[model samples]
Target chain A: MRRHERHEMTEEARQELAAVDAAISGEAANGEHAPLQELVRALRGVRPQPSGEFLAALDARAARGFRRAGQEHARDSSRGGTARAGVARGATQKPRRRALLALPALGLAVAVVLLAILLPGTGGPGPQPRATNAPSKAVFGAAQAGPAVAPDRAALQPAPAPTAGPSAPGEQARQVERTSTLDVGVAPGNVQATAQRVFTLVNAFSGYVRQSNVNSGPSGQGGATFDVRLPSSNLAAAIASLSHLGHVRSENDTTNDVTEQVSSLQRSVGDQRAQRASLLRQLSQANDPQRAAALKAELNAVEARISQREGQLRALRTRVDYTRLALAVTPEVTAGASTGDLTPSAAAHDAGKILSAALAVLVIAAAAVLPIAAVAIAGWSAVSLTRRRLREQALDAS
Target chain B: MTLVAPRQLATPQQRLERLYAESREDLYAYLASLLGDRTLAEDVTALAFERAFRRRRLFNPRRGSERAWLFGIARNAALDELRRRGRSAALAGDLAAEESSREDHLEGVLRRTMVQVALGVLSARERELIALKFHAELSNPEIARVLGVSESNAGTMLHRAITKLRKACDAQA
Candidate 1:
């Protein structure tokens, strides 16, 4: 209260309280409030004696020294809730306080943790994942039991020399188009040699390279990428053989079921062949020139369609029979690597970029969590106040 | 309201024991009056002491005296019981019963009956105020602290309650 408000008692209130002492004490208040004094005396006499049984039970409990039963939250948490009690209750509320503080803090911590988890995801393409000095083994480890999981194949990952398709015994023949990516890091001066070894491995697995790009840097420092297609049955083994040439930095596998497309193309090809055979038999027996010409033209059109459909079917079959692999070979970063990009300044630049990214993530996390934490704290405080008010209002109610 | 040693000098257990020794009767009387049930008042009174003992370290003598603090706890416990029962404070069957028929005169019995009936005329809040003022014998400032009200507001409420009690008594007469 302000200085004046604390001392701003009115004369009427002063007189109203003048006999309060004498009246409550049941003494005569000089004939001014004699009636009030009598009532006070009567009220004082209204006290009823507690039964001896209850007193004995109470004395027994008190003798036992009151063991804690943890029913204290209702009474202990809000002890001395006034401002003056803050310093006093702080000591008493210590153990119970961690519970109150942790609730809101836990909410904020979850938000920041969620933001941190999403920091590296989906924001205009942050820097590509770099291959650092440390070698990592990150196979998705959640897929297994060997059912040629297309979508979940990236989950536990294929073992070395894995047979990762419906080609397994007792499985239905599921025509699938499979594509995989593997990034291998080789020691300096071995990129070109590694690229050659990859081609050799593909050939051993009866696969062919459709495209190859190798950048040969000075001092045997370079990188290579190849789009190779291997026989479907040998895909997993071929990758396993090729990965032995270098350190596998990253790997991904994907599959698409093309069973319906293959089936449709097969039906189209069969229909075209049947029609062409009928036209050939009719052309051999035709006698009229004009009619023959018409028949021949129709036959040619059907023949062309047959060839086109056959070509389409062949391509579809080829795709289903072979899995495409994109392999990238990069020089492993090392202390003795002969790349100019491995200089201290470049390392510092990379570190700076990474630091900047981490800071951005932290700032974004803070910005996201601050408002929520504010609302939570405000809500918690308001709820506590309302609950206390309601508990007090219980007296006014039933 | 007893003058005691420095709070810091004594352990919380010692202080609470002293508070119990000094104030148990008044505490029970105040609760029995507010709750209007001998058994319930006894239960809540014991509950108040147990609660007080469990939270002994929380008592800050700087805020108010030990009696006021104990009364505050007792009041809250009684109020909670009252709220749970979802009824007004009905005078106990034994509360207004005449005690010691041999020593009790007819005039005293009638006076006690009239006072008890007049008490039934007040609201639960008014009854609690009267209990605090008369049975607990708390000063207005101490009562204000226990009730979470300003000193003047407590004084005004007490004055109004007392005035109503007098009017109720006259009507009963």
Candidate 2:
């Protein structure tokens, strides 16, 4: 039927039908339409009812259904509790997983830092002496070349010894030039004595005091500064001895390898000498005075070049054989001294150093973690988006 | 069975059990009228009750009485079974056997057979309306809610359905 026509029955007609329906069901109705009432009566009388056996079966089935529903409710409640507990466990484990993932990165960073600290030739810029321990062709060649090339070079080479086996690259000794600075605090009365003791120790180690300066204040607070050079073999023992003279405030040690530099210098010296020898031979054979003079002057220039290279090589060898030590001795303040004696600038300097170190660590850690976090977030988003799209497609199919 | 308790406060399940006891016979009759097979009616009635019991938590007393809600479920169940069987024409074989097996008076049996045959002449929707009206005994407004239509529309449709059944019965006579 059309939408508008379905409900077109008048109120009066509806009331008549309702009355007929009431009469058919045995309720009080206006006494009209006897035949229509009879038909409704017959229809109502024939209404079907279930047999007794069917009713018994229905009751049994309904009871079972109720029992099943109750069991499902119990199971759901238990599952809910288990899910909550699992969520709690997962929350606690999340950070531990992050820590576990971070372990290798952290280890890598620590290894980089320790390598920078412990390896030679990887320190701040400073005056680097020659390295005595490394094998150098210059030192060996200088030993054969004699005193005319360099007066000090012969003393720097080791005595000739019998060989055991051909040296491998891995077994080659690194030519490291060691330098250190020490700051020590001593009793005001002991400052002069400490300087004398350091001087004596250097001399005993076949070392020499390069410079020494002592100053005393009007209140008898005195300090001394010493610049010394010591044989490399005695460097550690001298430093230990100096440390006992006072409370050692601070120390810094650095090493520089100069094996390649010495080798290059020796090669240059050899080339210059060959050039000088050729010039001298050309000068001796020249008959013309101008040509002879030119050859002689050129020979002079080559000889001077050779001498200059030999001098440089000699200096490098001496430096490689010795270690430099810069020591500062200051009057110590007693524990009972006034607070005014403390230096605020020094304390602030130390604090700044600590802050910078902490900042460096944070930057390194961030560099390691940020990339991994970004990749993980991107992967999770992609998977989630794909899952949502697939779910939408499945719903559309259904 | 005595389904009504005169004096007691009852839980929701208890209330549902009482409704089930009170309405099971009528609901079975409604299903039989709608589906036209005694066995199918019993099966559909049980399925409808099981569904009602499962979804009882969603029931609101203010919506309609338990009887209307149950009949609505039974109506859907009967239609689903009919659709599954691919037989929307009418009850034929089992209904004939049931009528022949009846020990009642011959006139009463003939009247029932005529009524069943008249019901077959109506469309499925018309037959459902007639069953809800006479067998389930739901009011116009309750039937409207169960069928998801306006009360006036439910009454009009039911009236038209009854007129069709009356015409079919007269022709058979």
Candidate 3:
């Protein structure tokens, strides 16, 4: 609606101005704008004129195309020129130089920022996204089997992620069931060698591979996985050694403490055993046939309880004695796998990693820049708006 | 089919020169009315042209016409001069006194005096509105562009100034 009013007013103003022009030139007139025409003619008569000398000088300057104005002003300024000359030079030169420098400056800033993000070993960490769905648990301390262990836990921590369970103070001899999963990659030919190395590595740690399914299929696109058990004390060392056999794609080592359960079962077995001994004694002391039969039945029941509790204790002990590892060895040709092991899936995975890295960098850069740019633009707009308002107010104030 | 020829474009300097030639007289008139001092108006006019020439390439035709752009610069310069002076355009009794003395035609002197009195009745902004409309020969939209105002507001202000001037002129007569 305001736009419509503006258009209407503009049309009226245009016609009024045309009528004023006609009135002044004595070509035509409009009846409605008689006063406006009279006023315009009076304004033209009262308008000021430049002296011939001033007009001639300005005309000559224009003929020269304003080219010599700068040189003349520069020379004048060197000789302590007029304030106008100095202002003119500053007005023209400063903004042009700034415009010329703007693009490279912005480009340099973005380049520096991207380099800070992308370059390795400049104290910037790689995008290490968590690539697993492991159960989230309390951040546990190191395997506190005691300070008597010899291997350097810190050095072994570089590969094969170790998920430690909390070991409270003075909780010694914990019956923990350790479990780990490892996804390792090897050269195609090394699948067999790497698998053999894995078994030998386990054996060296006094562990055994209980279930093995090693397949380098016809296309050689297959992998090997092992269900193995190692001594709880040697679990970390075994994982570290296994990781050295190939590119450790992913690894998770988790531990479960079942010491209290084991202790409860042991107590139950002891109680049952004592009950059995007492039942037999009562059986021997029985004077009547019915009494002897009842004592014998009680003895049998005690024996059954003892046997059940003992079986539970044994199974728990087996878990405490060894740690289970699920190790999957996928064929990795580019990492020295035989030519047959190369698969489009592997190449695509690599390409995906590169793409993900690029995307992460771009995201980080955008995250860093967009907010500042938005603030700058907003601030600039606010200042421009305020400045314009203030300039218009100057007219009112005058 | 008629053959069409590619139009040659003028260089920026050439264009600036053309605008200077066309608008210099009226621009000076507008500045003189706006400032009410001949010497200051001259200096401001020169300065405005210099600034326009320096910043000619900065002009975007899509935003406004060349004349509007030039007048906008002049308006800013004249306004700055006003702000610096911290007073209204010194349109005191002496300017009218001097004008009446310059003319020998008695009837012309009387008419100019009446017009001068009518103009003097306007406020500074109203006087600028009139100067932009008549002396600068700017259309209302051009006035709006120069003054950084909406077209409707410029039209309303122009109408009000014209009405006030008419009343003042009638009373003077």
Flag regions of model 2 displaced more than 4 Å. A1-6, A28-31, A63-65, A68-398, B1-9, B89-93, B100-103
Per-residue lDDT of A26-134 in model 3, one digit per residue for the tens?
A: 6645678777667776776677777677677667666665555655555646433454464356446756967765865596577657765666533322223233221
Q: List the residue pairs that clash in candidate 3.
A: A187-A336, A187-A337, A188-A337, A188-A338, A189-A338
DockQ, Cα level, model 3: 0.29
lDDT of candidates 1 onward, in order: 0.67, 0.64, 0.68
For residue A270, model 2's alpha carbon misses the true position, in angstroms, by 29
Please provide, for model 2 over A56-172, each residue's C-alpha lDDT reduced to its tens digit, 9 standing for 90 to 100.
Answer: 866775666544432332344443354223323423454596797677667666766775566443342211223333223433233222222332343333322212111224525
TM-score, structure 3 vs. true: 0.60
Q: Pick the candidate with the highest lDDT.
A: 3
TM-score of chain A of 2: 0.43
Estimate candidate 3's alpha-carbon lDDT, on a 0 to 1 scale.
0.68
Task: Encode model 3's per-residue lDDT on B1-173: one tens digit a residue.
Answer: 11222243366776777678778888887887887876666666776787788788998888777888998888777776666556468553335555665668887777788888888888877888888878787876788788777877887778778778889999978
- Which candidate, 2 or 3, would have the higher DockQ against the true structure? 3
TM-score of chain B of each: 0.87, 0.85, 0.89
